[model samples]
Target chain A: MYKLICKDGNAKRGEFTTVHGKIQTPVFMNVGTAAAIKGAVSTMDLQEIGTQVELSNTYHLHVRPGDEVVKKLGGLHKFMVWDKPILTDSGGFQVFSLAGLRKIKEEGVYFNSHIDGKKIFMGPEESMRIQSNLASTIAMAFDECPPHPATREYMEDSVARTTRWLLRCKNEMNRLNTLEDTINKHQMLFGINQGGTYTDIRVEHAKRISELDLDGYALGGLAVGESHSEMYRIIEETVPYLPEAKPTYLMGVGTPANILEAVERGVDFFDCVYPARNGRHGHAYTNHGKMNLLNAKYELDDRPIEEGCGCPVCKNYSRGYIRHLLKAKEMLGLRFLVTHNLYFYNKMMEEIREAIENQNFASYKKKKLEGFAAEQGN
Target chain B: MYKLICKDGNAKRGEFTTVHGKIQTPVFMNVGTAAAIKGAVSTMDLQEIGTQVELSNTYHLHVRPGDEVVKKLGGLHKFMVWDKPILTDSGGFQVFSLAGLRKIKEEGVYFNSHIDGKKIFMGPEESMRIQSNLASTIAMAFDECPPHPATREYMEDSVARTTRWLLRCKNEMNRLNTLEDTINKHQMLFGINQGGTYTDIRVEHAKRISELDLDGYALGGLAVGESHSEMYRIIEETVPYLPEAKPTYLMGVGTPANILEAVERGVDFFDCVYPARNGRHGHAYTNHGKMNLLNAKYELDDRPIEEGCGCPVCKNYSRGYIRHLLKAKEMLGLRFLVTHNLYFYNKMMEEIREAIENQNFASYKKKKLEGFAAEQGN
Candidate 1:
């Protein structure tokens, strides 16, 4: 399913094939938590922006329009009208973060739904079943995401519990993928590595998860609240222990600069909500830095968001016009920036992949870092 | 210039040419009050949905971004990135309806901005100047829109003052169009007919304005709180007095059936915010009636809003999906419905024009009224 094509130092270029389509390496998955991107972006717009994959949250889908509802309507791919491959995150992250009164136990975590106060229980088996019903191309194994700044003992215990949970998730996914009623019989699973800034725990967790022979590997809980140097240290320490023949995904790790850094360290897949969320607030990502359209300096500035950016918004609309729309509370303001930001991210990935294939990724990374002066979003 | 193609009874099939583009007769102008459709529908989306002319509000533009800001950025058409013909409403309707602390006189009306409560005055010349800065294909003459229950004496005086304002507007627009830096040198002006509900006063006002040789004439303030019968009665009594060579616009007068009735009474142009505003609230205009998507029964209906509706939304998405988006408070829900409804209205006008050309408008109108059961909007 994963074929490595070339490598420029640690940056490897590969093509991952799924039933839906082939995704290029260094790909950014557009986040559509509820099957529709926030700020009114549609699947059609995603295709126009060169999105190779869509990442949706299992917690959100399971809450509002239940997983069964999506299954009845023919899964997330059909529901969203995107024929591209889809990746579904395990319900663990949102269940831990969003749900109130969450209780942790070996059987499952009992919690109240974030949308309503309805009590719900989700274990490894439950998350696997939901993802099976959602019928995405890639399903993440359910694991508890430990909070940041944990003691070494707590990190050790959490990693151990996550490993046992991964085993259960793997068994449940294998069984669910073969059931006659399963929407996607060939669904792939990728186990997440969690160790909260501990190199030994991360390496041990990565090695144990790689033994399952999953389709991909993901470094989760790194960008949760860790500093850049710590995240880089953990990734550099843990990646060597994993079976890197498979695709490596950096879950929820962000920013244009972050992507460049991760690609250099061999992270293949990424998804973040920054572009869409920041865009709704009138922040635009430009090559110079991040341009906030709400700033009064752009009131009469007729230039596009950037001089040579080829996104449709920048190609047709001026910074002044978009700024006015944002000031006036027009929805197009959100849409224009969202579309442009996504296009910028997607184009950035394409350039990164090209640089990797050409064996010049280091120079590309250096040039990009030199140009971007502003701090990327949290 | 207005070229009368043909007439089937009072429903005429004509074409009106402006410097920007030619608009087909019996056309519906999509209302983009702040240079944007309320539901985040973009100019690109409008083009795909068959929008002929975009009607923007001079008051909203002048208050929010300020018309001077738009001119500096490029003008309404370029700022909004719409290449089609645009018609701007004079800052008169909103001044009376939306502004506070308003005082009326022969020179102009002084009121506080609805947004910031900042003091601002607008007269014939001020309105013309703003419209010129917007550089729309057509501009409306400034006139008072009296309340619904005004006395006959009040109506007569208001009509007389409107005529005096019309002369001033004509003088100002003529001079503004010839200005060296004017974006639209050939900007056309449409004179408005307002006499409350008095048929005699309406006829006299319409006759007086038609003599100005304006590019078009509009019947304003009729739909401002009047009964459907009263508005229809006013259109029937007043349209005959307007010039045959000019396009007669029914400003803000609506409903699918209301439009048919006005077309039969010789009205040729229309603009209203109902389609977009209703769509934002999940009300869909179907051939049968207005269907609200927020109703819970559509949860798993798995059907399009209307069958045999040749809209992009209808062709690609299901009512069930759109309902899910709406229930989840997703903006795509409003966008899909807005695009679908506008396409529906534009398609309806096209069908209306075809029926007029075929000399079967009366039958078409009769059949349509029988089918639509719900009231359009308040």
Candidate 2:
């Protein structure tokens, strides 16, 4: 399913084939957490912005529509009408971060739903079953994402339980694939590596998960309140131990610069909600840096979000018009900025892949990062 | 500027030439009050849904971006990036409906801005000058939209003042259109007729306005707390007095049935916020009737919002999917429904135009109204 096309130092260009479609490596999965981009961006708009894969949340969908309901209606792809590669994260991250805590037993965790505070328990088997019903191209393992600044003892214990959860998740997914009513019978399971910010623990966890021969691997606990240098160092220490044949994903991992740095560290897939979230608050990411639409300088500026951006929004809309919409609390403002930012990220990935193929990724990453860090003009 | 092609009884098929573009008669002008559709629909999306004319509010734009800001950035057509003809209503409606305190005098009206509570005064000349800054294809005259249940004595004085305002609006518009810096040098003026629900007052006002030979005329103060039959009676009584060479407009109106009945009564142009507004609340107008997505019956229904409808939303999305998004408070739900409802309305107008061309408007109106009033099924 995973094919490495070329390598330039540690920056690899590759493609992964899923049942839905083929995804180029060094790709960004547009986040549509509750089956829609938070800022009124539809899947149709996603297509216009060069989106390859859409990432959805297991917790939100399972709680609102229920996995059973989604299964009955077809699947997440059909539900959202996104006929592309879709990766669904295990409810683990949301369960740990959003839900009200109760207890974490050897089997799973018990908590209240963040939406309504209703009692709910999610074990590895339950998580796998929900993903099975969602029937996404990739289903992540139900692993506990330990917070940063954890002691070695807690890290060791969490990593061990995560391993056990991976085994259970893999076993359950295998069973669900053979069921007659399963939406995506070939739904692939990916194991997650969690070690907080401990480099040695991350490397050991990576090696242990690599031994399972899963379809892919993900660094789960980085970017959870850790510094950028710490996250980059951990990725460098851990990635070499993981199998090069499978795709490497960075979970809930960040900024345009962060993606550039991670791709150089051999990570393949990434997703984040910052584009839509920031757009809703009137922030836009241009090649020269981010700018706030609320600033008075943009009130009469007639240029696009980015001068050379090829996105639909930047192609026809002006900064002044979008700024007026934002001031008036119009939804189209959020929609335009969200569409523009996602296009910026996706285009960044496209450029990254081309640079790696031409063996100039190092210079490309440096130049792009510098451009992004530079102050923007009106 | 008006060209009559044919007539099916009172319902005529024709075209009206404007500075921006030619508009098909019996048209439904999509309302973009405050410079945007209520449910995040953009000008690009408007084009895809077969929208011809876009209607904006003078009051909202004047208060927020302000007409001077728009004029500096270019006009409403340039600001919105919509090349089609735009019709901007006089600020009178919003000033009366939304502003805090207002005092009417022979010169003008004084009111506090609903947004910032700042003092503002506007009269016929001020409205025309603002609309000149907007540079829409048609600028409505500044006329009082008298409240429903108004006494005959109040209606008598209001109509006389409105007639005076109409003359001043026409004179101001002529001066602005000839100015060297005017955004649209050929901007046309549209006079409004207002008489509450009194047939005699409405007929007399219509005849008086028709004598001015304005580009278009609108029946204001209808559909404001008045019964459908009473409003229909006023249209039936007053439309004949308006010149056949000019387009007749009905302001802030109505359902599918209301539009159909008014068209047969000789109305040509229409504007309303119902489709976008009702769509935000999950009420959809289908061939059968209204469908509320909030109902649990749509939980497992995989059909489109309206089967056989060619709108973008209906073509690729399902009822179950939209229902899930609505339940989760996702914006895409409102967006999809809004797009569908607008498509339904625009398509209805297209069908109305075609039926008049085919000389079957009366039968078409009957069949459509019955379908819209029927019980919708899954």
Candidate 3:
């Protein structure tokens, strides 16, 4: 169960009560793609750095250690030592994006593993079962992530198939919750809405999923290589159709700037690998802009990555030292950058919630967008 | 001035009162090769994780940022945001190992920068002046780190040249400290004892440098490719010749097992890149033995890297998650390992100090080594 703690116009400040803990709304789930955040951020570090939720990939866990193995080891939370709420994405995205020789049918998809080329089958039921085995607080319904430039006919067919899969996911979740072996008996299932870049199709699909009355609704298939305006237009058109009472998650929608925009349009949850991934390339997100630590200009710049930022990296390390690490190709440099980026996103959400509570969200949104756009030099 | 606080057999506990802060002896200085720990550990993380002294390379910093630039930016402490003591290496080792077109003369060595083929000159005075520009608490004397398997004649000439360099280093350090333009007026100098695996030459060099009455004395040439037993034998033979009242630092003298052996042999200070370097490769030091996170067995292991490890990583992360991060080539994986390894070394030192205090040093060393050896077989 969750409660709407506060609201300001289209924006909401809420709390999601889970078995593990409660998560504040407009929260950013740090992406731990394979049950660990890339760049070595541990669950403890995540907690210290103010992460509310950890999002793990059902596909990666299912492939490497096997969901059954995780189940035997007492679920993903115990395996990763993350006592906070964890949301496990349905393996559908990876099946579409990472797997080889994928064959999609009405029931499910059969594909070869990207790691070992081993045959694997992932349907709605299989994804639900895997999430159940992992015992995550939130399990996403398996829905085909359609290609960005998909034909209208293909988009329509994919949405219908996704709706059917959502039903199977719901039924499987119900069965798993009743099973005594399940680690989280009260696990919540969030249904995903998928339609390729078409607002009419997206709104219709969102309306259909809203009727199912899932715990939450996610706007999927937008950030899959579409124009930012097109993605924002789809969200703006379709979000009103989703249940206003439930949390609206924008799956894999990104960046500090993107989150601010999405939150202004009323996205309550978000997850992205940008912070951890971009950190590996030596790019750190600062309030001014994304600073590349590899740039020679930072060689002797003794300033922190950002002033007035209280992250551990910013609080004690100078840009000069961080630049040195990046130049040396040290992993610590990446870790520091990723840690700062994640902290930046989480802190931005806090500020967003504060603005919402103060009834100044409009001003806050305008200011933040302007600040970010200024960094873009447009 | 440094003061010897306590002594139990050959194991001594002491404190070096520096301009920045007091440094506790039998201390391990965390190495920041390029002004940053190789893994994403920053100065703030270092402080939280119990680091007292940080070591930076003179060669790398001079090459990349340039010493003149660091001086312009208020020296390395302000540059790195570490207020505690910092020790800058003389660039002698890196110049010999990493630089190109090295030419050794009685005055100094001329070499090309490792990053660019630009010609550079570094003698004892230049090394001391660069460290003074960086304003590190302790500046290591510049000395030629002779290649292993050198003939007796070569080693003798190198040691003699190193002696001349030490005199120059001491005189330049004094001159820089008195200069009004110097960034660090209180900078201290530590003379290096280099004899390249020859104990008679090492003893003579140590005695000669001891008469210079420098702030500290360091045994520099032991770890550069000599067998462990041969290095241990040299320390056993030469340590008695070094002044008992002054602090004795062993440069780049290593692994947890190696450190324990050195501390027992009356070495009061140590620095090495092993913890951070080995960690990036997925190797972690545990009380048991070094555990490789890349091993398949760790994939489902839910325990911390060490059971009682109080570091942030061990407090909340599982071996399983760390293994997954390492397998994924994540920087966070390397950071966690490095953080844990540094914590392990520092904690071991604390334990060693405690044992010495309780007059149980002998038994503690024996038991710890036995346990470590037994775990290696597993």
Candidate 4:
């Protein structure tokens, strides 16, 4: 269930309730691609950092540990030891992007697994089944993520096929929920809107998917090499057609600046690998842009990653020590940065929510963007 | 200062006070080579897992980030954010073993660093100066670690040189502590006893070092390629010559069984890489022997690393989940196992101390050894 608490212009504040827990939005779901946060972070660390939701990849879980194995071990919640709500994406994106030699048909797509080069088939029903086995709080509708820079004709065809697949996924999910053996009988489905850079196709697709009255909607395939202005324009054009009562998730949309822009355009849920990935490379996000810990300038600097921050790493460690750790190639350096970066994102979301509730989100967004720009000179 | 609380035969229960903190005797020092526990664990994690003393490598720190850099940034205690007693080993072991083409001389060993292959010299005074810059609570005396299978003549010459180095180390440490700019003004020195596996040489070296009345004494060069029985016999023969009032450390001595054997032989302090190293490789130490999480048998086993264990990992994670992480190449798996293994060692030492205080260490040692042997079938 979704509750719209307040709004400041197009920026919306919301709360999403699930079987696991209630997540306050606008929220950033920390991406734990394989049921564990990369950079050696645990669920306990997630809780300590004020993370509300965790997003895992269905494709990765289905491939290595197998969704069936996760089900036998009591689903992703018990498997990961986190009682917080989790959102598992449909395996379509990974299968389309990561797998080798894929052929798409009405029944399903046939491709070889990226991990082992083994053939596998996944249709709407199969994706739904794997997700049902994973039994996450939210199961995304299976849809093909069309590559960027596609023709209008190809975009139209892909959107049509995705709509049909969404229908099948909805039906399969309803049936699966009624089964006695289903792990999450109340699993929520969120349909994805895909139309590449074509604004007309995106609006049409958004309107069509809104008719199904799903629990949530997501704008996917937007951050795939598209310019930031084009992505923002597409979101502005497409979001008005979707129902505002449900949550709006922006999939794989990145950067603190991008998040601020998308949130202003009414995107309520977000998940990206930039924070975790960049953290591994020794880049730490701060209020004043990003700081690379590997820089020699921080060798003798005894400041936290960000002064006046509330994260555990900031409270206890110094940039000098962290720099030493990174130079020594200690994994804790990456872990520390990851924890700080996630906390930065999560805290920003909290501030965003507070600004929306206070009806000052526009100024908050402007000042936050200026803060980053002032340091990054972008 | 060392206080003897009680004793059961040779096993002693005591407490040693340092400037940083007081350490319970029969303590196991968690090896944090290069100022970090190898398996992505932080000092905060160490505190949570009840780690008493953190042992760092003088060689590793000197080579990377450099000890001078650590001093400028405030010292190892602040550098690693650990306030507990830290014991930095003299660079002697690493120079003898890890360095390339080392030439041992009376002034000190001349060799190239293992990391950068930079030509460097580290005699007793140099080792003391580096450790002083790091500002650790206790610094081991710089001494050569004689290689195994050495001729009697070689053993005698190496031991004589080590004794001379110990005298130099004591003088340097005392002078460094008196300096106005030294970070740790009251730094303590622990002399090392190294005579290969020859009992007569070992006894003479121990007696000669004990006469210096340093804060502590250590038996080095025992666990290097020697039979377990032979190593145990050497400990039995050499520990008595060292001062019973001061702590005796068994350097690089290993395994749960090995620690128990050494404890029964009157060794009160121990440092080894076994728990953290074995854990990174998927080996977990338990009361009932060691379990390799990489083994296929643990794939579907839904049990903790050890049931009824008070470790944070055991309290939250399952063997099945950890095995999944390992198979998927997740660092959290190694981290969980390492935390659990260190807790296992620390908890065992606590039990040993308690058993000694209760005056039943012999029976306790027998029972603990039987527990490990029963599962390992050794």
Candidate 5:
């Protein structure tokens, strides 16, 4: 179900085939956490703006519509009307982040739903079952996302638990796939690597997960709170040990600059809420730099957000108009910014893939980073 | 420079030529009351979404940037970055609606600026001078928008004072146009008719303003607090008295159904904030009726706001996504709805013009009204 199409040094371009479609490797999955991109972007908007795989949260769907409800509605694709490859995070990150009262044991985590205080138990097997019900193209393996600044002893024990969780997730996923009632029999699993900022622990976790021979491997727990250099260091140390032929996913890794840096470090497949979040705050990423529409300087700026941006917002709207909307607390202002930012991220990834294919990833990375950082002084 | 292009019954089609551009008559001027569409739509969004002329407020601009500041920036068109013809409302309605401390007299209403509560005086000459400085394609003559249910005696005096204001406005506009310093060298004037709900007073005022030979005329003060039937009745009584060659504008007159009814009653121009305002509240206009994006039924609806809406929002987003945004308090959701609503209104006008041209307006009006009302029932 996965093929490596091209390789340049440590970087590789591949394709992951699913019922919806085949997604090109190094693809950026637009984060639609709850079957929709936050900030009012629609499925049609996503398609127009060049989104590939849409990543939904299994926990969110399970809590709201319930996986059974989505299953009844013909799974996530029909439920969201996005007939493109969709990868579902196995309720791990959200369950770790959102659940107010959680008890971790050898079996699983018992927690209360964030939506309501209903007690719920989510383990590796339950996570796999939910992903099967949703029928996603890719099902992320259940893993514990460790809290930042943990002790070395705590980090080691957590990695061991995550490894154990992976085995159960894999076994349950296989069992579900064989069931006739499962929504998707061909669902693929991507195992996640979890460790604190410790390089040795990260490599150890990566080595153990690789033994599972998952369809893809994800480097998680880095972007959580670590510095750019620290995150880069971990990826540099651990990626060479992971299977090079399989796609490397960077879970919840961010911004255009971050993505470019990660891609150069041989990481593919990313999802982040930054573009949509920053857009809602009236900031938009342009090739020139990020601009805040709420600033008074844009009040009468007749120019587009960026001179040559092809996004609908830039193609038709002036900075003055966007600023006005922002000032008035209008929703269109945020929607325009969010749409533009997502388009920018998606476009940036396309450029990165091209650079890697052409064997000039180094130059592309240098120019893109310089352009993004240059705006900081302003 | 205004031409009567076609006529079907009392309903007619015309074109008003302005220095900026020629404006198609019976056109619906999208209201951007304070140089921005109220629900946060920008000028660029307007152009792509089919806004022909943007209507700004002399009162709002004069209060915020001040007409002098806009003059420094170079007129309303340059300030707003919309090259299309723009029609600016005289500060009359705002002064009546917003001014905290106000006193109306023969010279002009004396009031405080709504924004800063600074003492400000606006007579016909002042209104003309401000509009001339702002350099809009067309400037509306200052007229007191009388309150509904006024006694016949009060209505008579108010209408008489409004006539005096119109003459002063015309004289001042002519003088300003000849001055080399004036931003708009040939600013056209559109005098307004105002006479509570008194039919006799309306006809008399319309006749007097018509004789002034202003470039266009407006039916104001209706739709303020009157029934739709009452507003239509007044239009029928007064429209015949106005010059047939010039365009007739209905200021702030209402819903999709209301516009259709008014067009059939011989009104030529219209402006309203309903589409944008309603859209911000999550209500969208569809052929089936108005769909509220905040409703729970849309929580899992993978369909667009409307199945075939050509607006960017509907073209690209699902109803479920829009609902999610609204629930999350995301501005993008509101912006999408506002953009879509404005597009719906502009498209309706285009269709209305086509129906008139094809001589099927009567049947078109019947069908549209039935559909809209039926949708509302559902």
Candidate 6:
């Protein structure tokens, strides 16, 4: 259940209650692909960094440790030892992006596994079944994530097929929840809206999925090579069509700036790999933009990654030591940066929610954007 | 100051007071090769894992961050945020083993660095200067680590030259300790005993270095391709010659069984890379021997890595989940295993110390060795 506490312009301050726990929107779900955060972070570390939700990739989990394997171990919560809400993406995006030699049909998509090159078929039912087995708090609908700049005709057919797949996904999820062996009997499904860059198709798809009354709604395929302006415009034009009572997730939607813009346009939930990925590359997110710790300028600087930052990394380590670790190719360097970046994202969301509730989101967003551009020009 | 608290046959229970803190006897110093524990462990994690002393490589630190850089940043303790006692090895071992195109002389060795192939020279004074800059609580004396199977003549010559280097190391450390700008003004030096596998030369070298009245003495160059019995014989012969009242360290010495044997032979300190190295390879150290998490049989095993183990990893994570993470090539898997393994070794040291204090080290060693061999025949 999502309760709209307040709003500042289009920015939303809401609370989402799930079986696991409550999530205060707009929440940035930490991406823990393959059941673990990429840079040696554990669920124990997540709590310390103020993480509310952990997001795992269904495609990766299904590929390596099968969903049945996770089910046998008592679902993802028990498997990862994370008790908070977990949002698992449908295998749709990875099936289109990562898998090789994929064939898309009306029933489903057939693709070779990225890991072992084994043939696998995943339709709405298969995707739903896999998610049901993993039993996350929120399962995304299996929809084709069309690439940006796709033709109107291709996107039209894809969105129609995705809508049909959403219906099948809802029905399958309902059946799985009613089953005796289901790990999470109350597993919720979030329908994703995909229309490439077409506003008409996006709005239409959003309206169409809105009527189906999913537990949540998501705007997908917007950040796939689309310009920032274009993504914002599409979000502004399409968000009004999504139900305000339901949680709105921006699937795979990006950086600190991108999240702030989405939140301004009423996005309530987000999951991205930018923090973890950039951190692995020694980039740290700060209020005043990103700091590349590998820079020689930090070789003798004893200050933390960000001065006055309250993150665990900032509280204990210095830029010089972390720089040396990166130069030495140590894993702790990546872990520290990743932990800090995720905290930066999650903490920004807390500020965003407070700003929205205080009816000062416009000023908060302006200052945050300006701050990101304040140091080293981002 | 080194205080011999008690003795159980050859096993001595003692405590060493350093500028940093007190280190209990039979302690296993966690090796953090490059100043940071590999496997993404930090100083905070070190404290949690019962790590009393941290061991770092002088060669690795000087090669990357440079000793001067650490000095400028307030030494290794502040640099790594570890307040516990740290033991730094001289550049001798790596200069012999890792460096390329090395030249050994009466003064020191000149070689190309393993990292960037840059020419470098390190003598006894240079090693002392580097450790003084690193400011570790305990610094090792520079000595040639002769390979196993060396002829008696070569072993005798190497041991003699090492003794001369030990004298030079002592004088330089004394000068560094008196210097006003030195990071660790009270840095203590531990002389290394090197005589290949020749017990006669080993005992002679141990007797010579023991007369130097250094803070501690380490049995180096053992466990370097020698048979277990041969290494044990060398330790048994040499340790008796070394001062029983001072702390005895076994450098680069190995496994749980190896530690037990060395402790039985009156070794008070040990350091090795097995736990961290094996962990990176998906191997976990347990009381019932080692468990390879990458094995197919652990795919669905939901039990902890070790039953009744109080380490953080085993407290919350299951073997099945850790196996999945390892198979997915996740760093958390390695971190988990490494943490548990270090805790296992450190916890075992605690047990060893208690057993020695209780005057039951013999029976304790028997039961522990039997327990280790009880499962998996490791």
Q: Tell me the whole-model lDDT of each prediction, alpha carbons only.
A: 0.90, 0.91, 0.86, 0.92, 0.83, 0.92
TM-score of 1: 0.98
lDDT of candidate 4 over A193-235, digit per residue (tens): 9999998898989999999999999999989998999999999
In the predicted model 6, the residue pairs found to clash are none
Off by over 4 Å in 1: A374-378, B374-378
| Candidate 5 local lDDT, residue A41 | 68
Q: What is the Cα-based lDDT of residue B86 in candidate 3?
A: 95
CA RMSD (A), model 2:
1.1
Tell me the tens digit of each residue's lDDT in model 3 across A46-101. Answer: 87788999999999989877888788778989888888999999988889999999
User: What DockQ do the predictions score, one after another?
Assistant: 0.76, 0.84, 0.55, 0.81, 0.28, 0.92
Model 5, residue B259: displacement in angstroms? 2.4
lDDT of 5 by residue, B1-378 (tens): 868777777777778888888887678888877676754456766878888899999998787767876786678887667899999999999999888889998999899986678999999999999999889999999999887778999999998999999999999999999999888897899999988789988888888888888898999998888888888889889889988888888999788888888888788799888887797788999876888888888777777887777887777667776776666565556777888888888888888888888888898888887777674432
Best by DockQ: 6
How much TM-score does chain B earn in each model?
0.98, 0.99, 0.98, 0.98, 0.97, 0.98
Task: State the lDDT at A193 in candidate 6.
Answer: 88
- Tens digit of lDDT per residue, candidate 1, span B16-90? 999898999999999999998877788888889889999999999999899999998779998889998999999
Fnat computed for model 3: 0.73
- Give candidate 3 regions above 4 Å deviation: A5-9, A286-289, A292-300, A375-378, B375-378
Model 6 local distance difference test score: 0.92
lDDT of 3 by residue, B253-325 (tens): 8987888888888898999888978887899988778888899887778788888889978987778877877
- Superior by DockQ: candidate 2 or candidate 4: 2
